[model samples]
Target: MTNENRFNFNDALLTALFGTPSRKNTIDRLGIVCPVFPDEELRKSAVILCERIKKMDDFSWTALCKMAK
Candidate 1:
């Protein structure tokens, strides 16, 4: 998929976790304002979790996300 069509975390994750984008300023204030990785513990945990999830087959990942909701 192209970048626009790809399931970007900015598009999917934010919408899933926080809802939709609704900013009109210089900053595209969309979704929950998640902090970037300076917060080491959270960042590390997320990275590890993502790595684990990434290892799952496509069907499993899709199911996991579906069930998570």
Candidate 2:
């Protein structure tokens, strides 16, 4: 939970620090690369969402990514 808001979005270290993103970030980047994600208006704060995503195990996180698409 360090203040990494300014950290480079393209840095290899982003995954290392924040852990793998849940179904959100990559899906956002997907727009036309894939379909819309499941929830577009859940409206959770980014800080809270990132913390929850980080707590997920690797397998669960991967599953979410696939299901998102």
Candidate 3:
């Protein structure tokens, strides 16, 4: 698939998983600034970040929770 097409698909998947793109949610989830992209790109980046977050260890989760609070 083309790069644009792949990006769109990834974006759609992220929106389906995370609702809308917002700094609040990203910060809450201990994500980076990449999710601040425009709607399409934001969604795609969010999905990628989500996958990475899922692989984080307990220490990472604890830090995220603390930061979120």
User: Which lDDT tens digits does candidate 3 get at residues 1-69?
Assistant: 445223344444443444333434543553544457567756556656566555656565446444444
Candidate 3 stretches with Cα past 4 Å from truth are 1-38
Ranking by TM-score: 1, 3, 2
Model 2 misplacement above 4 A: 1-44
Model 1, residue 41: C-alpha shift (Å): 2.0
Evaluated at residue 37, the lDDT of candidate 2 is 28
lDDT (tens digit, per residue) of candidate 2 on 1-69: 666443333222323333335445533433332233244332223334445455666676666545443
Q: Estimate candidate 1's RMSD in Å.
A: 11.3
lDDT head-to-head 1 vs 3, winner = 3
- Per-candidate total of colliding backbone pairs: 0, 0, 1
What is the TM-score of each predicted model, taking all chains together?
0.44, 0.36, 0.37
Number of the predicted model whose lDDT against the real structure is largest: 3
Where does candidate 1 stray beyond 4 Å? 1-35
Candidate 3 versus the native: TM-score?
0.37
The local lDDT score (0 to 100) that residue 64 gets in candidate 2 is: 51
Q: What overall lDDT goes with each candidate model? A: 0.40, 0.41, 0.50
Q: Candidate 2, overall lDDT? A: 0.41
Query: Candidate 1 has what TM-score?
Result: 0.44
